[model samples]
Target: MEPNNEQAQGLYRLCYRLTNVIYPGWQYRPIQLVRIDERTGNVYVLAGESDFEIKPTGGYEP
Candidate 1:
């Protein structure tokens, strides 16, 4: 199935962030962004077999 433009853009942006902005110093650590179910708003970040869970660090849930 082909993803829409919005989804594509989101995926690319997420990838860029993960590679550059998020972990600029960690080149050895590979990151994978998985958009589990956009229809159900299920997105995840996996760094190995575990999902990189981001806990609330005193910020908005937006």
Candidate 2:
């Protein structure tokens, strides 16, 4: 499924923040949007050279 503008923006923001927190100082190259949980409204972004599933907690809940 294609993400809308807002969703895409939100996901990008989330990805940026997650990258800093979860993989600090690492050169992260986002590969693709792997998945977006409908229940949780959580976006899964696959970053190159890492196997970390960064889930943003707090403020966002769905």
Candidate 3:
């Protein structure tokens, strides 16, 4: 797999774990990579209705 894809999957796992904590009673659907902005090194993910933007600096922009 591509390095970016691996990174995205790792981030996706983090996002999923976070959602489970925030919403314990919810059922999970698949997480998806909505987009990747290489110039800014930003990864966008969709987890159910929640969205996340992961920056290269190591933080989430909800």
Q: Give the top-scoring candidate (TM-score).
A: 3
Model 3 agreement with the true structure over 1-62: per-residue lDDT tens digits: 12265556657666667556566665665566566776777777776677878766545666
Per-residue accuracy of model 2 over 1-62 as CA lDDT, tens digit each:
45556666666665675456466664546555467666655555656654333244422222
Q: Write the residue-wise lDDT of candidate 1 on 1-62 in tens digits.
A: 34445555555554555566456653333465554444544345574444542222211111
Candidate 3 residue-pair clash tally = 0
Report, for every candidate in turn, its global Cα lDDT versus the true structure: 0.45, 0.53, 0.64
List the pairs of residues colliding in candidate 1: none
TM match of model 2 to true structure: 0.39
Most accurate candidate by lDDT? 3
Q: What would the TM-scores of all predictions be?
A: 0.41, 0.39, 0.51
True-structure RMSD for candidate 1 = 6.9
